[model samples]
Target: MLSKRQSKYFKSLQLKKYRQTEGKFLVEGAKGVEEVLQSDFEVEALIGTSAYLSSLAENLKSKAKETIEAKETDLLQVGTFKSNNTGIAVVKIPGQDRNVVEEKGLILALDAVNDPGNLGTIIRIADWYGIKTLVCSMDTADVYNPKVINSTMGSFTRVNVMYADLKDYLSKSDKKVYGALLEGESIYKTDLTDGIVLMGSESHGISEELRPFVTDPVKIPGRGGAESLNVAVATAVVLDNFFRG
Candidate 1:
């Protein structure tokens, strides 16, 4: 059973401020909850319906410090989507410092990629390519957004996302900057160094504010009528080549 105060607190997490203040976020759905359970991040509490609780009783029993069986409606109140309330797990924030940017090789940087789904898909792709860290500009979408988290499909467990002053970070790093651009040299023909691969927003390419920081600009050639490729698709293609090279 969920107390009124608990329900209110969980629901408030949907807002960014509350999540920041409490240093916790809600992970909804079975896959997301399972990821949280398996991840190193601390689990604060777990709430679910009886059926949902019964389904994962064994797994949730050990990892979660507190587990409460509540009505489906109560679970829905705190969940991002009302369609499926498999479970809701309150996860402590992973306190990531800016120092992670100095880590070597193929760091993916996002320049105002606003779509949550696109951001999540990119994170999944990054995880698959073994690029464990992502640097997002301050304008990028929130990593913990429900849409972003849902789209990641549990790949978030292995990826570390950090927001920073991307332009300044790129400028100062000794790592070569490879920005994806329209008129840039073909990715197939270019020689990519072991460094950061910067991708841009869906609507706009890399922001003008960051263009000066790019040491190497590359592009994927296309013969199609479309103006450009989707940022997520482009990211996959670029990472694949970078990973293989």
Candidate 2:
């Protein structure tokens, strides 16, 4: 059973301000918590049932600083989910300065995507397509938000998310920039082999500040008249085109 202070501390991780202040975030669900255990991220605590803890590899069980066995009741008490919850972990957020992106590597750059679920789905898509670096404007959804973390499932462990000034990052670069726009050329007609793929928020399209940096503005062709594709759906389609090319 968790003490009052311990429960309070874990509960605080659900909020962005507390997560930032503590330099930690919560990773919920069996897959997500398991991935964090396997990765280089530091796990401060693991809260789960006895059966869940017993199922982990011995080495993985040993890596965590602390492990507290709890029932479904405790999981419900502290987790963001209402049901089907298994585990929740308090883990250290890795520094964003890691130079993981190689020169000429294909990257996904997000503008001001505010939806946490969209951000999470985007991370999963990036992982699915073998893209390792995901850069977002400082205004993009917080990767550590509980919704985003839950949505990633487990891909959060594989993708490196960097927050920076999009304009500053793209303007000084020489690589191709493909901006997905409603009024741009067909993505099928463009070469997406290299450079950054810039996507915008769910409500707003790509920002004007970043337009000057786009080498080629492209869009997905649609026969039916839908207003526009959802950001995550559009990103998946765009990435699929890149894969098909």
Candidate 3:
């Protein structure tokens, strides 16, 4: 039985305004909820249908501020979006700090990657290769965007995604910066080290303002004239080639 306030709160979380006002976001599905439960995030509430609640009985002792068990119909009633039948959990959005990247192993910087799925896929790609830190331009898609969360396939738990002024960070950074361009030295031939690999937006390559800061301008060699590759695909190719080698 959801209280009237709980109903209102769940509805509010659907909008970015409410998420910002409350400093929280929503994670859905069994995998996503399990990721949140096993992560360091502070969960606020867990609401589930009776069927879902029974499955989580062993771990449901208020991992959050409140755990409410409701009938399947009730859980579906006030759900902000289509509840995937796996239940829903709300967790505090992790506070992101860009300065931490300066001391980390390898950090990825996104210029203005606006697609939520693309950003989420890249985050998953980063996690696949153990690249934990990500710095994005302010214009990039919000990591907490539900679409992005869904796309990460639970990799969000292991990755830290932050937004910053990419140009300024690149200019001030001590790490070697490599920018992927269309007509530069082949990425296969470039010497990549433990540093930042700057990936650009979907439509455009690295922005002009930040291109000057690139220590090594590299390109992925291709045999065909396909114009270019998808940003997330390009990221996976670059990270796999460098990290697997």
Candidate 4:
């Protein structure tokens, strides 16, 4: 069982302020905790119910510094999840290499994407499309946000995300820059692959600063009545076309 002091520590990590101050965050639910454990990340504690602890694989338990048994109510009280179905993991934030991604293969970039759910789904989509490197603008959603982590459903372990000045990165890259816009060339006709694909935010599209760097403004032709496709949905569509073309 987690003590009062420990519970307080876990609960404190729910907010971004504390997460940044302490360089730690929470990964809740069985699948999320399992994925973190499977990765190289260090787990400080694994708090779960009796059934959950018993059901965990031996290798999974070995990854954590300590395994703690707690009641469902206690976990729910401390975690973001309304119901603590399985467990919550206290993980130390892994150090990242902040150097600009070298233009080698297809690198995915996000420009001012503030939605956590969209960010998470985009991470999953990047993983599915075999995109190892992801760059986000400074204003993009926090990758460590609890909602984003939960939405990734474990794909967070596979994709590498970095936040930087989008214009600086785009200005220096020699590779082709493709930005998704409403008034751009058809993605169907464009032979797009092996370069940086910049996906903008839903409401604002690409920022003006980043706009000057886009060498090729690409668009997915939609014959329907929808205003615009969601960022993740558009990313998937673009990647699908890239794969086929």
Candidate 5:
């Protein structure tokens, strides 16, 4: 059973301000809770049904500072998910001091991708392509957003997402900046290489400020009449081309 204070605390994490204040975020649903438990991320607390708690290994159960047993209905009230019968974990947000750009591998970067779902899908896409790091503009959606975390389907555990000034980050790096633009060279023909693949918002595409830094502007050829691709799909398409070679 959850105390009123405890329930309130967990509920507060659903908002970004509260999450930042607490240095913690909620990982809802059974799969997300399971993945966070397995990762190196620190688990502050675990809330689940008695059966769900019992299903966890002793070592996994011990990872949390505290554990609370609750009914499925109780779990539903504490998280953003529409359904959560299994469990939810209060996880400490890891420090974001690591380098986003690597010396030898391709890095995924985002510019003003404010949609949580799009950001989350892109994180999964980055994980799929084995791209370890993702740099995002400060305006990008928070990676710790519950919707984003839920959308990753556990890929959030594997991908390193850091936010910074997109323009500045690109300017400091010597690697080629491949901007996904509609009028640019078709991604199918461009010579892909290791560098930053900068994707912009669905509505705005790449911002004008960041375009000057793009050493290579590439695009996906569209035979149909679609004006633009969803940022997440475009990212997967671009990454597929990069890793195809």
Candidate 6:
């Protein structure tokens, strides 16, 4: 059973302010909890029903500093998930210093992607393509937001997401900045390379400030009658082209 104080603390992690202050975030659901346990991330506390806890291997169970048995109702109340019967793990946020940006490999960068779902899907997409490092502008959605973490479906454990000044980072980098834009070279036609694939927000395309940094403005040619593709979908399309080329 979870103590009142512990329940409150776990619930507080749903908010960005509390997560930042505590340097911890909540990973809800069985899959997410299991992935976090398997990853290098530090699990501070694991809260789950007795059945869920017992189902885990001894080594995986030992990963948590503390484990508490809770009812299904308790989990639903403590987490952002609508239905959480399996578990929720309070995990320590990894230090930003550990993410070292390299100039050689393909790196995905986001600008003002405020949608938590989009950010989460992008992380999963990045993981699928085996792109390890994800750089986000300071204004991008909080990666640790429960919505973001949940949407990743455990891909958050594999992808290293770090927020920085996009402009400054772009200006300093010698690698090409392939900005996804409406009026730009078609991704299929352009000679794709391993560099920074910069994507913008859903409503607004790439911001003006970051435009000058885009060495290669690329886009996916559309044959359909859609105004624009969702940021996450666009990312998957662009990355697929990059992977193929």
Clashing pairs in 1: none
Using alpha carbons, what is the TM-score of model 2? 0.96
Summarize candidate 1's per-residue lDDT along 103-177 as a digit string, tens digits: 766789999998989999999999999888899999899998878888888888888898989877886788888
TM-score of 5: 0.97
Q: Candidate 6 residues 1-245, lDDT tens each?
A: 99889888899989899999999999999999999999999999999999999999999999999999999999998998889889999999998676777556899999999999999999999999998999999999999999999999999998889989998999999898999998999999999988899999989989999999999999999999999999999999999998782
Per candidate, the number of residue pairs that clash is 0, 0, 0, 0, 0, 0
Each candidate's TM vs. the true structure?
A: 0.93, 0.96, 0.91, 0.96, 0.97, 0.98
Which digits, one per residue and each the tens of the lDDT, describe model 2 over residues 1-245? 77767888888889999999999999888889888899888998898888888888889887789999888877877778887446888898887556355555789999999999999999999999988999899999999999999999889888888888888889777888999987889988886677899999867899988888888999999999788889999999999998782
Q: Each model's C-alpha lDDT?
A: 0.86, 0.87, 0.81, 0.89, 0.90, 0.93
User: What C-alpha lDDT does candidate 5 achieve relative to the native structure?
Assistant: 0.90
Best by TM-score: 6
Model 6: how far residue 95 lies from native, Å: 1.4
Which residue pairs show backbone clashes in model 5?
A: none
User: What's model 3's lDDT at 144?
Assistant: 81
Superposed on all Cα atoms, model 4 deviates from the true structure by an RMSD in Å of 1.4
List, residue by residue over 111-209, the lDDT tens digit for candidate 3: 989998999899999999998888899999888887788789889888888778887877778898888888678888888788889989868889999
Q: Of models 1 and 5, which has the larger TM-score?
A: 5
lDDT of 5 by residue, 208-231 (tens): 999999999999999999888999
Off-target runs (Cα >4 Å) in candidate 4 are: 98-102
Q: Which stretches of candidate 6 lie over 4 Å from their true place?
A: none
lDDT, model 1: 0.86
| Stronger candidate by TM-score (4 vs 6) | 6
Q: How far does residue 128 in candidate 1 sit from its true spot (Å)?
A: 1.1
Better structure of 5 and 6 per lDDT: 6
Q: Write the per-residue lDDT of candidate 4 for residues 88-165, one digit (tens) a residue.
A: 999988776533465677999999899999999999998898888899999999999999999889898888888888
Better of 1 and 6 by lDDT: 6
